[model samples]
Target: MLRRMFAPEGPTFRELAVQALSSVEHGYDLLAPKFDHTPFRTPESVLAPVSRALRELGPFGSGLDLCCGTGAGMDVLRQVCRERVTGVDISAGMLAVGRARETVPARAPRMEWVRADARALPFGPVFDLVVSFGAFGHFLPGERPGLFAQVRSVLRPGGRFAFPIAAPSRPGSAAYWMLAGFDAVMRVRNALWHPPFVMYYRPFRLSDVRAELARAGFAVRLHALPELGRRPDGSPRCRLVVATRAEAV
Candidate 1:
């Protein structure tokens, strides 16, 4: 809740209101300049441990950061992938900020920033690994299978599509109500407004997502992202879903 408060470079309420009135692509474009300062960007705590896990799982030849807002996930890919790294998003403003953030090592992979919609990516099945963070809420529930198919479509045989998914907040809890309220407000806003902001926190359940990934031809595995820790019931608070495209028979 406090994270939604004022930040030195964060957008004002008026600016955010205007952005919310726009389409999703334009809204993100409007938000891109100060996106890193806002809480919407993926935090280092999650990224670091996910990076550690990726490094253990890979020496990947190439990687793509799907829906890469400001390219935060590229830092993880840079450490693990050997041949090439790419960040693709529909927002040119986000990609512009991300391009300025490029860091090259002594022997770095090739880097490319492509402005492309996630649903209609302009690439062959070439990436060895793919990852996304904090972007799925932008997609609708009905869009999940198509979205997963697109991710799977870009992966080479046996390549992995990975992302961290938080366990749903327990019912009747403050967290659950916060999410429920947010989605309720968003629904009303979209109903009353134009262009439709198209975000909802409650729709992306893990069970449904796993089923959709399976339907999209991915063999899915969930590994505890132990850095995010376990819930009181001992289930992981967050799990890294690794969905691999099938290898040729």
Candidate 2:
């Protein structure tokens, strides 16, 4: 299923296994060679729904893509921002690959990339919109507050920090079992290894996320992306969390 199998620089099994055992930054650097080919890259399915939602709320001035692995969300920013777009992440290898892509149109807003950790952005209140995709699992639960605060710091008052979140799978379902097994293995691996990856699928709950965002001074709103359909319980199959910073008086 991976297109990277045909690429000249694709990773071997041993390289991937070593990546899985490394810290988050080093793991992504190792995976950067074939990241777009893997299922781990945020699918276009999720990106489309998020773009549609942002269009309804936007025509924003400047935008930022946080933890912007391979700059997928930068495409969204290019579409919505009139002035400029910026992408920030800690992994230079991933950013190198992202810079090589021809995804942005020629007439799009000016784009810049910064190499910085999400916990400590090197920006001020300059962005009117901010978005992240599929990168939250890299942070431990204890780090969420600081990460959210850093994002908030880069956004102008009334700007938003938005991203898509999928519904949790029902207990006993195949997907649930798969995620449970993955998390279990990850827990064991972290216990046995130094520099843990901190990528658990279960700890990113919407309720907890909202509370943490509020603690970082954002007012949270959830919008259902009906295009992705609904679960059996009628909850949205995926939601776009829109956390807006109130205007500072």
Candidate 3:
């Protein structure tokens, strides 16, 4: 599995074991070479639904791909934004791989990659849309307000921050047990390690996320991405959280 998805230079078992014990950014840097191949990368299924939703709501002027790993979100931005698209990520290694990907043609929206922490973006309120995929679990709950504020700060009034959130697994299901075991292993790792990788599948509840977005001054809405199908309970299997920043004073 590792050989199929990860390049030879990609982290070895020992390297990954060490990286799992590091901070989130460093762990990603270590994993970047093989990231897209891993199950961790956001699937094309989710991306297609999100792109369709944004197309319905957009024609956005400029877009930002937050924590863009390997430029998947930037590709979505290219399809939606008319003016320009920028990808910002903290991992130089990841950004390098992203940059190595064939650039979108000049006839398309201009593309640029910036290396920076999401919590401290350097751009002004210049983006009409901001989208992220599969990177939120890296942030601790306490860090969410500040992170949302950062996203808000970079977006123009009425611009949006959008990302997909899948429904949590029902208790006693195989998926639930797998995630539970993973979380337990992570907790033990963090307890015994130095810089901990902050990823928890369950803790990033949608309710808490909506509240945090509101606290950051965004008007939050959840759009069902029907292409992903529905849960047994009939709730959307996946949703796009559209957090629009209120118009400035």
Candidate 4:
């Protein structure tokens, strides 16, 4: 099923190989056109539930889609924000595709795109809400503190940085082993290659991430996305992490 979809509309194996060997920014630029067709794009199953969750929390003034990719996450913002919305990413090619694909209706919140690394966002502390989807695997564990701080810096006091995170697959399960193998391969690839493509399947554990968010000056909370269903243990399969910036002193 997935193979048929990729072969027809997605990037060829050679294209993906070339991308994997390139720098993250360059690789995404190359992948921009066909990104939506690829599994790398956040699936609608995830996005729809996220949208429903955010809707309950918002009617926000302005929003930013951090590392927006092809702007699929922007649909969530459009539904919940009453003012302007912006999508920021490092790759010019990805930004271009997002801008072209997301056309605003006359009454919709205004849309804008900016090309900037998430590490150094080019904006004031203005946004009321900021959301990211499926972009965290790029950041190493050590880099998360700075990344969270950067996110905090761009948000107004009490503004929320929301993103959905799935529960880790149980240890020794097939999903666990698969993710473990993928991360191991990424480690090897980064060691052997120049301009490392930093996409790993593991390493962003919820416990560690919650601690980092607290240290980064956020009041972190979790909202279970019941729409995505529950695990066999009765815990949520996915939860939305809503990290609110501390109000001004």
Identify the candidate with maximal lDDT.
4
Over 1-249, each residue of candidate 1 has an lDDT whose tens digit, in order, gives 345545667888888889889999999999998888888889998999899888888889999999998999988899899999999999999999998877787899999999999989899999999999988999999888889888888899999999999999999999999999989989999999989998887888899998888888988998888888889999999989999997632
Off by over 4 Å in 2: 1-10
- Give the alpha carbon lDDT tens digit for every residue of 1-249 in model 2: 345543556677777799988889999998897888777778788888899999999999999999988888998888788999999999998999899884656678988988999998999899999999988988889989999988888899999999999999889999999999989999999999988878886999999999999888999999999999998878899999999997641
When summed lDDT is taken over every stretch of 10 residues in candidate 2, the lowest stretch is 1-10
* lDDT against the true structure, each candidate: 0.90, 0.89, 0.88, 0.91
Model 3, stretches more than 4 Å misplaced?
A: 1-12
| Residue 59 CA displacement from its true place in model 1, Å | 1.3
Which digits, one per residue and each the tens of the lDDT, describe model 3 over residues 16-131? 78778778888888888777777677778889999999999998999999999888898899999999999999999889989998466768988889999999999999999999
lDDT over C-alpha atoms for residue 233 of model 3: 79
Cα-based TM-score, every candidate: 0.96, 0.94, 0.93, 0.97
**Over the full model, what C-alpha lDDT does candidate 2 score relative to the true structure?**
0.89
Could you tell me how far off, in angstroms, the CA of residue 109 lies in candidate 1 after the best superposition?
1.0
